[model samples]
Target: MSKRIFITGIGVISAIGKNASETLSSIKTASSGVGEIQYLQTVHKGKFPLCEVKYDNTQLCELANIDPKTRITRTSLLGIIAAQEAWRSAGSPVLGDGRTGVFSGNTVGGMDKTEHFYADFMQDAQSGDIKTMLSHECAESTERIADSLGATGMVSTISTACSSAANTIMLGARMIKHGLLDRAIVGGVDALTKFTVNGFNVLQILDEEYSQPFDENRRGLNLGEGAGFIVLEAEGIAKEEHILAELVGYANSNDAFHQTASSPDGTGAFLAMKGALDVAQIEPSQIDYINVHGTGTPNNDLSEGFAMQRLFGENIPKFSSTKAFTGHTLGASGGVEAVLSVLALQNKIIYPNLRFKTPIAALGGKMIPETALLENQDLTYILSNSFGFGGNTSSLVFKAYK
Candidate 1:
């Protein structure tokens, strides 16, 4: 058997909550974080709804314990907060003895700051404080989180758009399975910025009101921002600590179908889900729940719903898209939903797809509805999907800790 990887800890910060506990509470109550934009100084403020973190930069800095005068980006600050929570939740075990690694994923990185200073920098490239652009690379936030947590070994990043965090978790699992690391801190973080908002706006996929995933009349997706991290350790090492969940199966696939949309048949989504089931050695019927990549966009919801229909057939497992609560968190969606999946297994509850109304006509009513808390349900195995731009897709299977 392959080396077992266990999730020892989890942390999250999104529009819904400042930490994992708060997020769980919101999910349980079906409280949505999507609303009018607050932080980002976008022209589309009243025109578009967003799942922006409630804390402003100053508040986030205080919560992250970052120096008030530090020139860090909101992306890094959000990551530090969530990553620190995960580290502490994992017992803050001694790491960086060359047996630990940090694998983080992100798409926005420090763009929030870059966009803030771009005009001034353009006016005077020589006079501008180049330091503001120092963290522009996608790896900067990952490095910041790793440094803050004292993860001094094998720091790296993955940036495959929305699947970034799922890929990071996959990488960490492989590293542990191959004896490259005994423990790995893995997750992704992204902060709202004018860049992403405008980008999605131009694509005509940003919902003016709150998004409704799997709904027939869904307008589009509401952009969101946040971070989530989980600590993965070899089973032997995890036995010394508390095991939150088990990482049993994971897979990544690329459809090369379209740059900004999924294929009509959800090829990448199907392949990734199938590959994950194969790796876990579990039948499709074994999945007790599915956290779908239902972004509420016309193409994404249709594609993912069709994929579920193909994979689960007539008796599709209970499934719902939590994005309606948190919005489309871009690269952090995978990590955020992964944490939710683990929480579902631990709590024996499947979260409702908030705001869901009419089901997608294409899927023949396969989508999970906004049912009451599925309390006492046998949620043993869960599959979480994250499909991103450029046809990059990933699926993670998290099981109840045995």
Candidate 2:
């Protein structure tokens, strides 16, 4: 028997706020987390803006109640903190016995630490502590989180650039549907570092000001750092506890058209959305709101917009991009937006697409941006899109569990 997947609990920490409550409050108020750099010490201090988490490493340790003396990377620290919140919110259920697992997604696992170590190593090979580099691998944070949570079964990590977190949740649901596990903790985490900032700047896609997703005069994107997590359980387990929402459908597709940029037609995105709708056995008109993968970049917005036009025709659902509030969080964007999507589903609210001025002309005027926040609307299904580097595109369908 195929079991349905349900989100039982959620936890998040981002530049807007430290926990889920704070995140929701920020969304309701339409607060923008993008601003001047604070915690990260980088040479491009005044050149670029970012949505940095307020707490430094020491503060995060205090917040997570971990020993300050323990050496850990920021990525692991952020993931651990968010995962703990999710676990606690889910009643801190016993997770071992091969019935539960932890799946995490991240792009820069320990590059923040490795960059520091590399600098020291360049000065002197023996100057940097080799132990700090031990966590450099992409799987390191996932292992650390699973260890902290005492999850002994099927711990894994997904590193598919920006879509990593969404893929992790997809994998977790697949596991439960196949009866490989009864429950899973899934999400993604990324902390800002000089490596990503400089890399994106090289690409000339890092906007110095607040990103304006879907805006006609959109410049580029603002890089941000944060973690978002949700606890997924089978139908039976969720019925015994409190169920938040249902993960009715998910699908992923790759354009294979470009290494970094999406196809102008958004073929991958269209396929992913169509496949997800198929999985849920729903039609285009059934989706009440869409959390778009609007990165504010010229290529991304244009591509995603075109895809929406192709899929929904002239009667598209009301859609908005929350990245304007949280910044483009790279790997963590999907997970953070997933949490926001859940909030919209449960509360029957659609957040405004902040800073949007005009729609893309290529969409042929089929798009009507949701600028003002709307509440008290009866919502049945909401679709969330996440597209990443290497043309990896993913879409998830969330339904209100009435």
TM-score of each: 0.98, 0.98
lDDT of 2 by residue, 79-176 (tens): 98888888888888888788888998999899999999999999999898999989998899889888888999899999889999999999999999
Clashes of each: 0, 0
The TM-score, computed over Cα atoms with residue i paired to residue i, of candidate 2 is 0.98
Clash count, predicted structure 1 = 0
Model 1: worst 10 consecutive residues (lDDT sum): 364-373
Lowest lDDT 10-mer window, candidate 2? 359-368
Model 1 misplacement above 4 A:
none
* Residue runs of model 2 more than 4 Å from their true location after superposition: none
Give the Cα lDDT of each candidate: 0.90, 0.89
